[model samples]
Target: MLDWLTSAALHAFGAPTTWAELLGFASGLLCVYLVVRQHIANWPIGIANNLLLMVAFWHVGLFGDAWLQVVYVGLGAYGWWRWGTGRVEQRVRSTTRAEWWWLAIAGVLLTVALWWYLDRWTESTVPGPDALTTAVSLLATYGQTRRLVESWWLWIAVDVVYVPLYGYKDLWLTALLYLVFLALCVLGLRAWREQLRTAPQGSPAWSMD
Candidate 1:
């Protein structure tokens, strides 16, 4: 099964398109679509997407991205439970100013740390961008799980970088996937913004101060 998944399914843009990438591409699209609808199922489906992409990234020497998928698995599980328990409303809400500051600080720190590690210890060709996208992905995924309205913005930023980075790595299919993701992120942002504007006060939704 592993061999078949890693094997080339076809050729596209002069690169071998593997089954893992194809599956991951489909799951990635579905997962984001579910997320736009605020569906709880997105979490588990996203976990599956992570696993498939982990294999795809590993084969292409994107070690940072491969490890990121492992972390996303845990985060996805947590998100599943959080949404299931209804402890936090699935409605979109703005992050507090302080929360934004902390997220920004963490993103910067993680990017620098990942860049240093990947450059020093790994044979990664695009260590700088790999680390950047990995770090932003962590932050964005966490924000999405929290149902923050700003998470879509973060995803848009990551998708912009990912499209070119994957193309450079000869992951043309993955690059094209990010292009689709870029569009989805825009739609998600608009939808979430509308939700935030219309949510009633004193509802279960998290309030912005």
Candidate 2:
């Protein structure tokens, strides 16, 4: 079983693809689709995708990205809990300019720091770009838990960069998957904005809790 799993991750790294990649890919697409539909199930699906892709990235020596998937598992759980226990304060809301400024500062610091670390400590061929996306994605995941509409914008930006980054790494299917994510972000952005229109200003949008 272990050997089979190892081989799956090593298979082409998306030259054509493998069951591991396909599993991750499909779950990723479902997660995005659920996000569009405002379904809380996205988080669990995202966790599965993260685990599957972790192996896939590890086989290709994208250590930073590989470890990133592990981090995402934690983030996914937090997201699931937050959404499941939907509170009034967690409803779709606009971020203040002050919040945006702080987020920008932090995100930049994380990206630069991770870029330097990956460049020095890892054998990754594209550490700079990888770090950029990973940092942005972390913040984006946080934003989702906060129910911030701007998270979709961050995801849009990440997908744009990730497509070429994964493609250059020879993960062709993942690159294409990123394109799908890009489009889904567009859909999610619109859907969430519409939800914000109906969301009670100071009340939980749904009583999922």
lDDT of each: 0.91, 0.82
Q: Candidate 2 overall Cα lDDT vs. reference?
A: 0.82
Give per-model TM-scores: 0.95, 0.90
Best model number under TM-score: 1
Collision pairs in model 1: none
Task: Give stretches of model 2 more than 4 Å off.
Answer: 8-16, 87-90, 202-209
Q: Can you write out model 2's per-residue Cα lDDT over 1-209, one digit (the tens) per residue?
A: 43464454444553656566767888999988887776788889999999988987887777878888999999999888878876425567788899899889989999899889889998988888889888889889888878789999999999999898888877777888899999999999998898899876665554332
- Tens digit of per-residue lDDT, candidate 1, span 3-85: 98899998999899999999999999999988888888889999999999999999999999999999999999998888888
Worst lDDT window (10 residues) for model 2? Answer: 5-14
Model 1, which residues run further than 4 Å from truth?
202-209
